[model samples]
Target chain A: MGRVVVDVMPKPEILDPQGKAVAGSLPRLGFGQFVGVRQGKRFELEVEGDVTQEHLDAAREAGVQVLSNPVIEDVVAVYADTAAVQA
Target chain B: MGRVVVDVMPKPEILDPQGKAVAGSLPRLGFGQFVGVRQGKRFELEVEGDVTQEHLDAAREAGVQVLSNPVIEDVVAVYADTAAVQA
Candidate 1:
């Protein structure tokens, strides 16, 4: 089976209150070097077969249309192996 | 400045209701090949200086301690550039 991953992030121009809330806590946690933090959502989908062009497209389209808010968020989708990714 | 990304996901063995909810919807969206879905959280942190080993350690530690639920979730931290990642 193949896998699809969608990452949804708030647009750079928008204010991220969740991120700000977390950022405000970094210093107390002994990580003041971190100047800011933005929170986002991740979706992982496991498909029943091999990865394909249509799968990739559908993953991206679903990421944009279903998982994220286009007015204030940016969506990106990953298909297949994410070994190179730390996650 | 360096960047830190923390990805938080439920342990594979655990049941993910949010994922199930979304997976339940893919078919109507014309992506039935995806048989399952898992929802997770992503934290993007913007640091104030150059990347370093200490920075990475802090990022990972923070990810584990602050961004994820230790009992049922898994956390992975990415340091610096995530160009290889779809995000």
Candidate 2:
């Protein structure tokens, strides 16, 4: 099986009130020196085949289309294990 | 100023109860074909310097040390814009 990791984050120019709220709460959470924090989504998928660059690309496209908003967010893809490809 | 985006997610083998809850709620939220979803943290930092690879690396290190559990999660760093470095 293959694993895909996607990260979704708000666009830089846009205001992220949620992020600001989190940043504000950090000190209360005992986290210091963390000037700011933005909240995003991560996804893990277990596909039925070996992990390949093509599979990664297709999964990423699907993620952007269905799970993320392109206008105010960005998605990134990461492979869990490259061994499947090498094997 | 340069912007850094960090994405943190739970490791694959670990159980992501929060992610499962989010995934379970997606259909009710009117999102379909999204078999699963995981939650994570994204960080955007406006560092007071050109965003060199060194800067990115340093920020990533700091993030891992403070915000993430290395045993159960992973972090990624992305550049917002490369124009400043080219100029």
Instruction: Assess the local accuracy of residue B28 in candidate 2 as a C-alpha lDDT between 0 and 100.
Output: 69
| Predicted structure 1, TM vs. truth | 0.88
When just chain B is superposed on the true chain B, each candidate scores a TM-score of 0.84, 0.80
Kindly give the number of clashing pairs for every candidate. Answer: 0, 0
Give the DockQ (2 decimals) of all models: 0.80, 0.30
What is the per-residue lDDT of model 1 for residues B5-77, given as tens digits with 9 covering 90 to 100?
Answer: 7788988888999999999998898877778889999888887666677777888888888878899999843
- Structure candidate 2, residue pairs in collision: none
Worst 10 residues of 1 chain A by lDDT: A78-87
Candidate 1 regions exceeding 4 Å error are: A83-87, B82-87
Could you tell me how far off, in angstroms, the CA of residue A67 lies in candidate 1 after the best superposition? 0.9
Count backbone overlaps in model 1.
0
TM-score of the first chain alone, every candidate: 0.85, 0.80
Clashing pairs in 1: none
lDDT of 2 by residue, A1-87 (tens): 555666667766668987787567655655444466666676665545655676566557655775578998877445554334211
